[model samples]
Target: MQKISQKSIHKYLRHDKKFPHVWCPGCSNGIVLGAVIRAIAELDLKKDNIAMVSGIGCSSRMPVYADFNTLHSLHGRAIAYATGVKMYKPEMDVVVITGDGDATAIGGNHFIHAARRNIDLTVILINNYIYGMTGGQYSPTTPHGDKATTTPYGNIDPTFDICKLAIGAGATFVARTSAYHAVETQSFIKQAFKHKGFSLVEIISACPVIYGRLNKKGDAPTMMKQMKDDVIPIKQYEKLSPEQRVNKQTRGIFINDTEKMEYTLAYQELIDSLKVPKGDSNE
Candidate 1:
């Protein structure tokens, strides 16, 4: 075990002002952000060689805070932008910071296709189960029967299992953790970054102000407790009866290092094969 100082972490933050993050007190976005920063730091990745792309939402704001080659793209278009970045500079580390709504709603098409291609991109989807930045509307990942601004009568629609969505869509590496488990979240993130093909680490986070207040889930700490209590370790989850497993959150690595053809590499091969030699080409 090595020591990591607060000072070391601060160096990665945007230094040209922007003090006082706008996230509400007890919001888990900051916790998730710290896990991301720590994972990148522990991996010893060069700041310049890494690129963070994000779409519109609370979680998508991660790119603005971190010192990296960042692109704050339009709503639900982060992955599309990131795909281009990865294709153009395949050597650079490309990561997407997206919210549940941003990744699964307007962005769902891009997300699934990106996963299907098995591109070398790490996607960190922070799932607070509500649209935290946009008036706490119901989102794709919102639990069934949960109350939201848009769903005053309770969410009638079945919620999406983002982890399953990623795995089914062909993500080679998929995992889930929570802001309450910072070290575990960071661990999964590091693994996601190291994996060659598409990887997704879904962080179950807290939105105390909007989602929590609307649902009467108490303040930030209370919501965080709910996050911690909601999950069973994946190993233990397997032992539970099917009846017992309903609505239980399971943490830990679901898939690791599954082999797949990386899209960027295949694309490069295509480009190389089509390139004609300078002397062989007709004028």
Candidate 2:
């Protein structure tokens, strides 16, 4: 028997053409990308069977580097595109790559509807707490007092609890993890892909170039350590009262395997039932 090297996963090298990715040296997008690839490899999915869709942002550029059927669509529309792809090709694995702004700002509506319909797609939302692509603007997930390009004086808006929103909007699987938790993040991605209904893995990534520098959140290591310190696992979160978990960075799966009719299969069943007989029995 011949030996195989799992460490040399082919998909990891798919970014060679665009080597030296656009993200900054300390940015965690690369880490998150690795997690996605590792998850796909572990799932044993063929490149042709997976479709990676991304919106317009630093996180949105993931599709360009992955060796899969990919679509780099407009900002805030990745979920919309992924929804269409899943509807037309229900068997294909569809994963959406979006940033904090792309997922919860302009793309919020699409995100909501996709979860509401229980679309069978995996959404990897990289939340760096700001618009990394667009001049470090305060995003929907930016902390209330964080500073951004637009919020030089400090952001006064409340942040969106991404995993909670996904669960509330009807996603069947919702999990929270950070880029620093590389192995766990990969495992979560695999779980998301394996799930039958809408699944979202909210990844807290580091944006040292923009978000971190603007907000004085320290270098990449410091920011990552912050997440490591603040985030709590799902079981631990469950132990806390509602007031205790308030404004906390909760990690782990919020929902898993909740029975829901997947949108694509439901649609197919509807069409199948609507088919009329070609001829009456008496005819």
lDDT of each: 0.90, 0.87
Q: State, as a TM-score between 0 and 1, how close model 1 is to the true structure.
A: 0.94
Across residues 94-193, which tens digit of lDDT does each residue of candidate 2 receive?
9999988998999999999999999999999999898877788999998888889899899999889998899899999999999888888998999999
The residue pairs in collision within model 1 are none
Query: Per-residue alpha-carbon lDDT of model 1 for 1-283, expressed as tens digits?
Result: 2455788889789977756777888888888888888888888999999999999999888888899999999999999999999999999999999999999999999999999999999999999899988899999988889999999999998989999998899888999988898889989999999999999999998888899998899988887787788777998889999999877899988887556789999998899998887886666
After the best TM-score superposition of candidate 1, give how far the Cα of residue 273 lies from its true spot, in angstroms. Answer: 2.8
All-Cα superposition RMSD per candidate: 2.5, 3.0
Model 1's lDDT to the true fold? 0.90
Q: Give the Cα error of residue 174 in candidate 1, in Å.
A: 0.5
